[model samples]
Target: MSDYDYVIVGAGAAGCVLAYRLSQDPANRVLLIEAGGGDGHPFIHMPKGLGKILFNPRFLWPFMTEPEAVSNDTGESWARGRVLGGSSAVNGMVWVHGEAANYDRLAELAGADWSWTHIRQAYCELEGHQLGDGPARGGKGPLRISLSDYRSRLTEAMVAAGVAMGLKRAEDVNDPEDGERVGYAPRTIWRGRRQSAATAFLRPARRRPNLTIVTGVTVDRVAVENGRTTGVEGRKDGAAARYTAAKEVLLCAGTIASPAILQRSGIGPAASLRSLGIPVVRDLPAVGANLREHRGIVMQWKVDDRLSQNRDYRGVGLVRSVLRYFAQHKGPMAGGAYDMGAWFKTRPELPIPDGQLLMSPYSFDYGAPSLRVEPSGGFNICVYKLRPDSQGSILIRSRDPADPPVIHARYASDESDRASIPVLVRYARRYVAQAPLRDMVIAETRPGPEFETDAQIFEAYRRFGYGNYHACGTCRMGSDEDAVVDGALNVRGVQGLRVVDASVFPFMLAGNTQAPVMAIAWRAADIVLRESR
Candidate 1:
């Protein structure tokens, strides 16, 4: 058995950063464990190569949700990364910091120092964006940011369309002080490769003698005695191993895994854990509750332009595209499927924006197991109900660590969420059919022009919908007794144990969570540092 000052689980986005910052002291020994292999996949680096693993189980958790009553005929499958850098290694590298109100809400709910002002600074300190150019956005940080080298006629048309429609293009999307702005999404990519957290933080920190990274290891649960965490018990290569935490134990296994780990350790809903024959450590009802994610539906259309990825991927053209990427790291193959989008209010009368529109110059066939490629050019416009009213949870289905959790996403359960989908979908159709882009539309692949009725559109939403894959709020932070973690990111009832990940989000942010998760770990490191003092 080995011991360290800090034992962090799940070397995903948060764990990687924690390991990097904690080991800066050289004196502090940090042990990090991951259930997945290291981030060495070819697709893990190429921005567009992600399409290769989108549906593959090689780098994914392959966790599917229970049947959604209102949405699709088939239940949605939740794809999470099992590798180092976790979802960051596998996700669509669109980097977003979320609206300021998102953090303001967390500060109010979690109490003190978590406000937008406090959290925004952490975002700046950890990430450096190319769009920011210099000081306005974070620069000189470990994470790399860049613009896509290739462009499609549809992408050019969409931006021109937005400009034509009285919408302003923002030079910087991550600007906290600037009001609403829509622009090309800046990605976590360096040159042409994905700049995953493992790539930005972990790989560089591994050289430190103070840090030890263990992969292909599964954590059973935290070993708690007398209400204090002693260490963790887990399995590595079919061998049982136990390690003690000299100073603290942090659970960065994400929303689903964090709560599942807590429940297995007897620290969740009392009745639920009791049924599992586990002694209760706390009666935190909100442990696995408050689960929310962005629900998106895509509408695709065929095009005749020379700019579509379809043109670049067809036979001889694909070989040229691959060769270009290999040589200069610049080509259509190096670009992401999506190129532009906007964050806006669902209803003009609403107090704030509640939806996001993502536009892409490539069509992805959802019905197929692999990415859908077409001989004719195609593009997609996706609508997402960003601030959802519906809620669900993740729970332990069995005591086995390998067993997947019972995930009830409950998408569209709320009537508001259900109603918002069609309106947004219709709006997406309107955007596609209106000026600039209207002339380019040869035909609609999903919910074609005839599906005008709300019921029809709702059905289309069910048929074409896929999760934005931004799951959060499982081990929520709150000041209330029912909250799983406190403002400091510490487990409510457990001593010397904390959870630092998307799981600690009291409410899901208004946009993509990758940067926000990095920000949380940035602040968490400070919290851990201060507490240690």
Candidate 2:
């Protein structure tokens, strides 16, 4: 039996950081296990090259949800990172650090110190903005942030369009500490490589003798005795084994896998655990109850000009582009297709922004078996409802570790979420139909005017929309009986076991969760360090 001061499950964004920070003391021994293999691919390092690995089963979890009834949408399949860096290795690399109100609300919902003022300090510490550093904007950190390197005449035109729409030009949206509406997204890219969690936190800590990283090991369950976590049991290289944690077991397995792991370990709803014949250690009904995720539909438009990346990503050109990226990182492949976007308050009077608009130079159809090409260069708009009211759950279907969990993402179940989405979609359509975008585009590829009316819009949302891969809130944080974890993120029913990933968020934040999740992990590290000391 192997023992350590700390064993962190899942070396994703949260796990990687946790392992790195906790092991910083040098005297403390930490073991980091990742279900996925090494982050050896070239695309994994290239910021813009994430598109190359989006659907690869080797790099993604490829989880699908159960069918939903209300919205006519059947179900959605989510792609989560199965690599060393987790989703950060394969994300758009957009570095929007969530709105101020997002943290403010989380603080209010969870407790004190989690407030915006406290959380913002942590955010500033973890991130290093490349565009420009300020009191609330930038500092010396591992994750490098900068504006999109690949700029075109089109990007300027896009800014013009936003101006025409009565939107203010944000100097820098990635500056969360400033609490202002900054424009031009600051991408999570460093030098030329993708600044994933592995690159930022894990790699540096890997040299430490106290930290051991085991890849391709899937942790099935947390070993518990008398309602306290003892260790963990799982398989590796076709052989099963178990390890005991001498100190604590940190579930950094993310929102989806963390809850599922807890359930398989018999720490969830008694009724559900009884069905699986797994002895219920903790009858925590909130294990997977407060599931929340950001969902969005990609709106495509065809353009008359062939100047977009859409024209660049086809046939022989793609091969050449890949070679160019490998040889040197200064090509189109070095940049996220999304060079520009906006965070806006849908209703003018809201205290915080309601939605985020992701702008790309090319259209993307998730349903396409293979990547399709637009005859001419075109633009794609991805509008996401930031503060969704919908909820979902992850349930264990069987005791088997290989079996996929039952994901029922009850999206659009909330009337508010259902109502708010159409408004964003309509706005996206209208924005593209006017001024600079309208002059460049020919027609809308999705929802195509035929899908007008509230019924049709909602139906289309159900049929086509998918998770932003930002699923969170399972094994949520709070102090109530229903909360799986407390304000300190300790699992309520179990001692010496805490969930420190996006799963701890009491509710979903208002943007791409990567940055905010990092901040939470950073704060979590301080908590763990303080307690351990």
Candidate 3:
């Protein structure tokens, strides 16, 4: 008398993959639920339209973090996608597989199943690269990977500058073997449209009768009975609704929502649950702990009008770009966020690149009330620590599931993270000062020439640094008893539940997280299938 053999919550990157893979078996009745509406927005498909729909609450959960000392005691907006494809539909479209060493570390913490070898094989099976298939690349998979279509003299100069600084030029930056390289970034964009997880996986699976998709449903919590998750309880169309799961309930609700959902289900820290007047099922303290994110600061330079794309984003130029995009699906309107990218070591003694830089041909005045392209000619170079040492937490604000959780993003709280800022700024200045870029001769617009000393540079970062939106490690997986999930991703204290997505990452990776989240879900589906049989 079960409604579905498997109930998958949140149709984001991980949820979409799980729904598709699990439903392949006709006997398994799968149900996928999303809190937000569909992904049919015109802006969602247009690669450059991210700036338009990113803050639109209709498509995302506009979660804001709690003010902390490190961030100058000011709360910042955190965007998490609520639509069918989730953040993948709203993200920057950067397709990075992360470093093999990071996954090798996961293998050491969890098991061999999470090793780089398996992850590489999964990438080979999951990607459809524009650059033809080979030993290291996959050309026949569902997700399409293409190089940035937008190119400019400024972007070329940026790459040349990296080469002039001794960084190796890589054909494919996604290649794990290419260490500390610079190149045009690969993206989840194909023929000018965003290749979101819903577009690649869930949409195709919709034809299957066994797969059911429900939107606008706000999941409250898992309905547990005798220490096992029987199903989920939530509100649909302003009425209470419950769905039973015959096999298991998979939580793919991302970092923020996954831990919150578990806490609501009476499965987190015992004292906190009791204080909220909720019955406790398990006393797992790590449910909403160990939050991590990449903190970054943007640097801008006022370039010559001819080399900048500022005009292309405003007035008559914008209208022309729009017309061209609708007619031919080509132009600045179809470009990804960062066209040129690089990884480098801030300190020469470091073994691998400790810092990452992303360059864009266009610049935005983020201090304004609304995000708009700068009226003047300019370009941006953003820098971030690859692996931040600071840790934070997510806790339920109240017993109500409708209330947004409190996000304590303790960014740069560690002394090392603070010290790295000056070094990173110096490295960025050096890169822009090299070769042909030096001739471009643009004055530094952000934290300009006045900020000279290390302390001044650190203060500049403190004033301008922002999260890269790659939040993870909330409900980390490990062999330790305090770990929320086991090596196979099963809830350690629950009988019929699993946490799939970036929340299960033991630590943050070295790059954008969308690609890694999808691959992890693909592997988790295999584990679920194997156990079910």
Candidate 4:
């Protein structure tokens, strides 16, 4: 058996960062286990390559949620990164901190350790912002944050439209002191290339002899002994292996696998485990509960064929697009799919923005298995409720780690969430109808102009809805009875076991998760290292 001071499972966003941070102490030997392979594929680096990687098994886990009535009995596709950088390698690459209120709420749930004042240090510690040491934004951190230089007629038009409609415009999303209003989001990109956790944090740490990265390994369960996790047991490339941790084991397998691995290790709901003939180590029912994700709808509109990038991808220009990426790294090849965004309230009384709108310069065939951007010419708007009432769960089907668990995303199950759909649509439609966006629109392409009735809108929402892929809350960290982990991020009812990924979030963040996930891991490392004293 191989042994180390700390065993971090899943080399995704948090896992990679935790390994990097913990191994800083030369005496602490850290091991990172990942089921996925390497992050060397060129598609993984290209910003616009996400459309090609969405359904590809090489980069991400192919997860399909159970049928939900809210989505019209359709199973939504869940694309989770299976690679070293985790979802950060395969995500939108947009870096958003959401609003300050979200972090304040986390403080209420976790502790003062997660409050904004203390949390700001971690934010600054991890980000290298474009605004060289602004009062609100950090200048030097492992992750390089830069603006996407790519442009499109539709992207510029959307920005113009946002200004025309009196929406809040911001140059920075991380700063609340300068009025953290929303606008076109920035990216975790550096000079036109993707900068994921793998590229930023893990890359530097990999050269450290104290840190070991074992890819193509499936972490089956936490190796628990005498109520404490000593290490982990899993198969690496079809061969069984055991690795012990001298101090503690941190679960960074993310929302889906983290809970499933917890249950497989006998730390979840006892009754549920016994049903699958797996012995229970703990009766913690909350291990896989409180599953939450944003419900989103993709609305497409037709534009003049000459105005859309769709023409660039059609025939002979496809070769040129590829060459453009290799030469300049910008053009249409550098797209992170989306270029502009807006955050606003669904109603005036709400304290925070209840809805979010993201404008992608290209539209795709939503019904297809693969994301094929419209070859002719068009763009899309993804509308999501910032805070939703809907909730669901993650449950293991059997004791086998190879069999994927069932993800009941149950999006919009709550009536409140259902009611907000129309408001979100109306808000998005109104924004597009203003200024240059309306001028560029040939017509409402998909739902068409006829879908106006409340009932009709709800139906359209169900038909077009897809998982926003921001799932969180399983194995949540809190002091409450239902919390899977306590304020210290230690798994309740167990010693020397911790969870340090998005799975531990009590509630999801308001914006894209990549930025916040890395920040959380940075703080987790501080807590784990400090408490060891």
TM-score to true structure, per model: 0.96, 0.95, 0.98, 0.96
Tens digit of lDDT per residue, candidate 1, span 1-533? Answer: 44698999998889999999999988899999999897787877877787777767878887878886555656777888899999999888887778777788888898767887777778777776775544335676788887665555677787666665445676666666424356787788878878888999987899999999999889999998888998999999999988789888999998889999999988888888888888887788788888988888777898875656776766788789888888887787677656776766656675545777777787755566556566678887777877787889999987898898999998888888888987888767766766787788888887687778998887777776877888898988888887888999889878999999998876668567888898889889988998787
Off by over 4 Å in 3: none
Question: CA shift at 137, candidate 1, in angstroms?
Answer: 2.2
| Cα RMSD (angstroms) for every candidate in the order listed | 1.8, 2.1, 1.2, 1.8
lDDT of 2 by residue, 1-533 (tens): 44787889998889988998899898888999899999989878877667678868899987888876743546566788998999888888877667777777777767775777777777677777774556456567766777776667666666667767767777676555423242567777766778899989987889999999999888999998877788899999989967778778999988889999999988889999998899988899999888898888877777655657765677777778778888887677777746788767678777667777888777664456776656566777778887678888889899988888899888878888978877888878767765775777767777678888888887777766778888899988875778898988888878889998988887767578888788888888988898988
Candidate 4's TM-score: 0.96
Q: Report the number of clashing residue pairs per model.
A: 1, 6, 0, 0
Candidate 3 collision pairs: none
- Error (Å) of candidate 3 at residue 413 is 1.5
TM-score winner: 3
* Candidate 3 TM-score to native: 0.98
> Would you give me the overall lDDT of model 2?
0.79
Which 10 consecutive residues of model 3 have the lowest summed lDDT?
130-139
lDDT of 4 by residue, 1-533 (tens): 44698999998889988998999999889999989989998888988787777768888888888887876897777889999899988998878776778878899998888877666778888889887666446789888887756566777788777777666667775666423144567787777788888998899999999999999988899988889888999998789988898889999999999999999999898999999988889889988888888888888898887777777776777789989889998777776657777777777777777778888767776666655667667888888887677779999999889898998888877888888988888877898899878988988876777889888988888887778889988988886877889888999888999998888887777557777788889989999999987
Q: Residue 128: error of model 1 in Å?
A: 2.5
The better-scoring model by TM-score among 1 and 2 is 1
Which model scores highest in lDDT? 3
Among all windows of 10 consecutive residues in model 1, the one with the lowest summed lDDT is: 128-137
